[model samples]
Target chain A: MKYTEEHEWLRIDGDVVVVGITEHAAEQLGDVVFVELPEIEAVVAKGDEVCVIESVKAASDILAPVDGEIVEVNEALSDNPGLVNEDPQGDAWFFKMKLDDLRVLDDFMTEDEYKDFLG
Target chain B: MSEHSTELKQTPLHALHLELGAKMVPFAGYSMPVQYPMGVMAEHLHTRAHAGLFDVSHMGQVILTPKHDMAALEAGLEALMPVAVSGLAEGRQRYGMFTNAQGGILDDLMFANRGDHLFMVVNAACKAEDIAHMKAHLADVAQVQPVTDRALLALQGPQAETALAALVPDVRAMRFMDVLSVDTLFGALWISRSGYTGEDGFEISVPATTVVDFARLLLDRPEVAAIGLGARDSLRLEAGLCLYGHDIDTGTSPVQAGLVWGIQKSRRTGGAREGGFPGADCILAELADGPAQLRVGLHPQTRAPMREGTEIWDASEGGQKIGCVTSGGFGPSLGAPIAMGYVDSGHASTGTPLWGEVRGKRLPVTVCDLPFRPSTYKR
Candidate 1:
């Protein structure tokens, strides 16, 4: 229920949403070879380009799932980018943003729904 | 993406790689692991600072034997290459290239004289064609046997020797470029104290059936970790090593690639050896003067990584197109962007201003001396 078709996941915490890549995206990328994060506190709109994730053979942009301001970034990725490939749903969360559109959650799939969609 | 219908070959460690969650991609007609859980940059830094293991089994390995006499085999090999192979010592390795009649390199290869036989390793992309070329030319003098079922693992890093010594004690005494037959925890293996990463390391060749177990044993060592093609590229880039297809191909000559050291002095001077090898006349001439275009290292000013096929412009020549970048990326160890490209000899000096045209925008760059990181081979 916290997943998007674009392979992004959102975890609601008060007014902020923590964002990260899904395990499927990580699997498709083969490895979390490199992560190019945006500057902290930068303002981003829904579906806007926020970050880049690169594997050896491919590079993809991580779009913002909801319009918000990036309040914090996972600085650990600068040294341990593989965390995204190892545990994308947990320690690999990209950043935290103050949500501007809670209605976007309705468009995302729940855990069970996402599993069915993947199948 | 282009789909290649060619059947992709797998190494002995293929199953193990998949079990460990390696992402496989087609490279040189083989399914190779490009990266693992650590990613490219981290693996690259680990290989430089610690030790990283790479599966390089796709590369071609061949054993050359004399059909009539050893002299004839040596002469036949020298006829196709520029290195002096006749006087090579047993258990020593020499880097060389096969050239066309016009002096352009056909393929870069490593030649090791192992007493009774001559051993060689070549680029995977050029292996089949290279073997066919040799078979067609030297069938009368030498017999080429392809060792397809073997596996090669490169253990590279600052602590590589220590980690390997714990497994194979005799490997500790092997000098740079020395090849030795040693016994390891797995079994007997052929190990060479040389690598492409410009570090103290060993490249071990083992039976295909036991490769996975051997790799697992190495990984068990606290200092050793599995690395993929991503780190392999960055490591070689920092070391100023050439990747055959990208940096030097059938169209480029060794002299132009700054690899003139591979040509022995004895092979160049003797009256009997004036012009025996393919393209000897053109190669010797270029060695005396210099190639028109030379491969040079570039240090870009911007953080953005310039990629292959990026055009290079001569700043002093009205920004004329002079060459193109062959390889470029961010070097984790060097902490900056580095690239290598062929430029006109006039603009090959260190600190010469050049331009790299990326996406219609020109990025300022400077020519710099190569081997951005000092080579730590135990010479």
Candidate 2:
């Protein structure tokens, strides 16, 4: 698993990449009321805004970690957005995408490195 | 502390906020808590279910003294404000606006008739200007005395009264909009049975020196939690209350902002005090003939929140821009998105279908009755 300064987290699962936001991002947003994910089969570039999470406070964008085409999104988020706040790194995974360039994964920081970067 | 932190003003509860792990954000020149660790949603729900304490000391509090010349003082105030402050009965408070010569709002405020004097509280951002304006205009009749030593605290929610009564016994007898001067263990306390969240609550004005201890005592209650501006905003929005800068401003009139209810009948045409306040001609004219636009409640049909600045479209007019959302967010209690904005008069009716354009996507929205949730005010 790796994290980006934009607060997105990505984990490699087979040939696809699992993506969501970091717990720090979830906490900063206060409450996760709604999440608007990119459409499936849509190609996105690294650092592009792929989703938006709206809380009672404000709406924040979640950037894509690597250049890829989205294959699946967490449909449960539509009915239960709190899933992001409850388990931001787990069941709240926003989407899964096929990596267009594997080297793009190296651009993010590892778990320990991300913690240091946050500090 | 950094140089920036030194520049931001701190309230009486500043130390307490840091001690309680509050996330302090700069607001209206003061470093105030935006939320506690429990998060905005939980704090909002807690207030609706029980009670939440807020430090609102940043808001300006002032005492308007007429020196026993009530009639002269009343006239002096009426010159600048739209509402008939002179008609306010003892212990009653009225919402009002200081209007410009053009019928635009200078600021929205609440002033209570204290039998011998008037107590006014204005928004934090507009406090200095409002105070200066009062001093410059009403100096001859009323004295503009700002209260700098007092800290304001709002204990709001359904359980507010019960939880508050435990600390101050006399609070139980006070009804909505009732103001009382009570004595507590800390010191003298002035409490008003009113708040912005449309909940049954009390606003306690205490000596700044003892505010932390006084607030701490309330937080010790099972039903009470320390809420911040995050929930304060959401609660007010769900209650259909207008935020000063967002919903109403210097460019909006009371009639257009849907604040005519705040004006007493005496201030209307053919009444005793008619046409006395600033912008009277334009305001009174609008009263007789409806304004071009009216503020109304809006609910986005989808889960996606339609935030402030989202362009509103009249569904019948081929997606033409009719208005823009002023305040919007997810209503925690309703589990949906809610908003308010000014729209053309004909499109302001409840159940009127409309569309909100967020980003490039047009989401279905509808005009609805304000206060998406029913108010539980003790009144």
TM-score, chain B only, every model?
A: 0.96, 0.97
Residue B354, candidate 1: alpha-carbon lDDT? 88
lDDT of 1 by residue, A1-119 (tens): 39988888999878788899889988777545467787888999878888877554445789998888999999888667778887899999999998766776887889888889899
Candidate 2 CAPRI grade:
high
User: How do the residues B75-103 of candidate 2 rate in per-residue lDDT, one tens digit apiece?
Assistant: 89888887888767888877878999889
- Report iRMS (Å) of candidate 2: 0.7
lDDT of 1 at B175: 90
DockQ of structure 1 = 0.18
**TM-score of candidate 2 to 2 decimals:** 0.97
* Each prediction's fraction of true contacts recovered: 0.11, 1.00
* Model number with the top lDDT: 2
Considering chain A alone, report the TM-score of candidate 1 relative to the true chain A.
0.92
Task: List the pairs of residues colliding in candidate 2.
Answer: none
lDDT scores in order: 0.85, 0.90
Worst 10 residues of 1 chain B by lDDT: B266-275
